[model samples]
Target: MHKLLPALLLAAAAALPVHAALPVADSQGEPLPTLAPMLEQTVPAVVNIFTRTRVPVQQNPLLADPFFRRFFDAPQQPRERIAQSLGSGVVMDAAKGYVVTNHHVINGADEISVHLADGRTLQAELVGSDPETDVAVVKVAAEKLSALQLADSDQLRVGDFVVAIGNPFGLGQTVTSGIVSAVGRSGLGIEGYEDFIQTDASINPGNSGGALVNLRGELVGINTAILSQSGGNVGIGFAIPINMAKEIMAQLVEHGEVRRGVLGAQAQDLTPELAQAFDLNAQRGAVVTQVTAGSPADKAGLKSGDIITHLNGRPVRDATDVRNVIGLLRIGQNVEMQVMRNGKPRTLNAMVEQPRATTVNGDKLHPRFAGAIIGDIVEGMPFYGKIEGVVVLEAEPGSPAWRSGLRKGDVIVQANRQDVADLASLRKVVRPNSPLLLNVQRREGALFILLQ
Candidate 1:
């Protein structure tokens, strides 16, 4: 019996350590780590943006009551309609009360209200907005406010942890955790210039202009758009990089608008067939299909059929790259471009110019034709799969061409029973007072035309 008791005592001692190794308990039976530090750092810098626009309210012509007429007749002024929109913004400068947000958030707004985390709502005025970059800066009358520190977005990589905070659906101050899905995303056609940071964060309708912060609670991006058919988050979202946003914000605050430099060259993506024809090693970079006469590229000796591989030492990944880099350049600044001519890389220097605000000419007809303009079909343009025709460059507003549903950019392959190659051929076929039969191709589909 004494031997058995000794063995039992040893067994009991062995089990004691296992019980002591159990995790310590809290009130919720979990580890206690405070989120106050992160909240304190980022919350104060985030602000709620509310915008109001006044639209003209049209009178209901069906209300024939004398009482209604008498009530609304005193004011001969246009009836005022109020539309309210809401989003989020980040306080960039505490001293100047400068805030950064998406341009669409405050576009055409008559009034703006900024709500701080401290339960203070103040009036905000638009400093400036750039539609191309989708960035805007606004100002409020406040001093010594908490402003967020910006992180270098260029340092971020895929799989890095990120946090997104905003007033989604007006549900005051929501935070979501995510990982960086991608970087340097462009050609989304969402905005003119896109270098978006792709993430899986829960960015919703009201999340636009919200801050996308890193684990250190530093702003890295501004939440902008999401790819979801239902308009809600579905594990795919995009944000404008903070670096681009910062640049636009600085320009907006100083110049009241962004001045983008232009190269004045028409570019197209190198298709696989074009790559084979040009004998390119890779189907990358933009192909200079045409250079506008007297433009910067033309003056710099850039010619058609040249492939632009680099701009100012940065790699031109695609057509978007050329646009984005050029767009950020200052007007009259000299920029260096690397082009591939005859399979040899050569450098050229060109002075950038301000982009003209001219409308795109889609009509491809001669001006002498009544309300018609002609354009030659440029090969290698992205026509929706397997369709080919000469594009329409212009159709005078309310002219015979306009009434016949002849839109700009429509491809006219056959006009007046003649295959149109260029403007001269089109003019030769269609005579004045002659009935014209045409066949047009559009992005959506094709159309048959008749003129009398």
Candidate 2:
């Protein structure tokens, strides 16, 4: 009866009519202050971004047939087509003309333009973009523009009021308000790295790369996505925290790309079954399924089945947590990982590094590898039936490797009977004028290519 009574009470509460803001009239019969003053400051900082992309249309394969071409004279290759897209962005720097937006908003764009609030349009330059975090940096030549101030998003808590300003549905600038629904949300598969700030704001299409600010007119987040069924706003939206965006922006503005750290480990979320097998106290952590042989994780003595509990003193709730934390760290930084092995806790120190191909160039390089680009597999790279290895990223046209049936997507498994586990190992074994035998793993089967 106690449980049933609560359920009945909840049903009754759901039937109650919703109310608007409290105290429409103040005690002295004067209206309360509205958000207009704050919006006045923030809305101007949010601008519309227009982009153009040229995409080549693919032709039908049957048109390429010899008989069809000879008899009907197949039409020339399909001409390139133009596609346009629009989104929102926030001005971060007025003097330097720096603006921030979602990476996907300007992805593959050949031409970009920023539309200001004061009836001025300027061509925008893409400084850099990081798809893992879905943040991008753009620059314009304009000066004396309005800029929004970024707040410490880490200081935000659940239920804090936030306002979303964007060009939703290309309807110019729009404003919506809601509370922070949740924080530190991850594993939603929205992007390669997901540390989103969930809000109940009415975000919709074209809101991507817009400003999500607080009442103090401080930038708290960037509206990036929404969770809706009917393709309209349903009070569920996601924003990339401004702090993470700032981190990526700094790198993009300086280096034109984000340099992320690699921990050299493959991980997955711990399941209840795995938790029982490992005799864990709780089924909440990332399990190290495999560690690269010579990677930082391996050098730090991380082994398979070791459940990672924390990274650099931050609690790791799942494999996404581990990936996000490691992905954000700069290369050459040091990290401390806490893990549980055999029901005991241990700490390991590892240096975050970027994966690079051990290059063997000049005469010492293998002829079969001379024009092939190789690298370690990073996050979001697609592979067939495998997750780790030194992959052939590209092959120069008409190059020896390209002519010898070696193609991209081939994973180098062994070289001359020695293990070619990663880019580094492959470089170590490749030599000129040697009996080089490469064992490759393709979608079909394992085959070897011999080069002398």
Per-prediction CA RMSD (Å):
9.5, 11.0
Runs with alpha carbons beyond 4 Å of true place in candidate 1:
1-36, 64-78, 271-276, 356-452
TM-score of each candidate? 0.71, 0.71
Kindly give the stretch of ten consecutive residues in candidate 2 with the minimal lDDT sum. Answer: 356-365
Expressed as tens digits, the lDDT of each residue in 1-452 for candidate 2 is 68799899999999987884568668999988899889988888999999999997776788757788778987656658899999999999888999999999999999999999987999998999987789999999987799998899988999999999999999999999999999888767677678899999889889999999999999999999988889899988999989888888888988999888778888889999989888887878999987878888899999998999999898888887787788778889999999998999999999987864343332235766667777666643434114456777777767787877678778878888888666677768877677788788876588988876
**Model 1 global lDDT (CA atoms, 0 to 1):** 0.81
Candidate 2, residue 157: how far the Cα is off, in Å:
3.3
Q: What is the C-alpha lDDT of each candidate?
A: 0.81, 0.85
Please report how far candidate 2 places residue 443 from its true position, in Å. Answer: 16
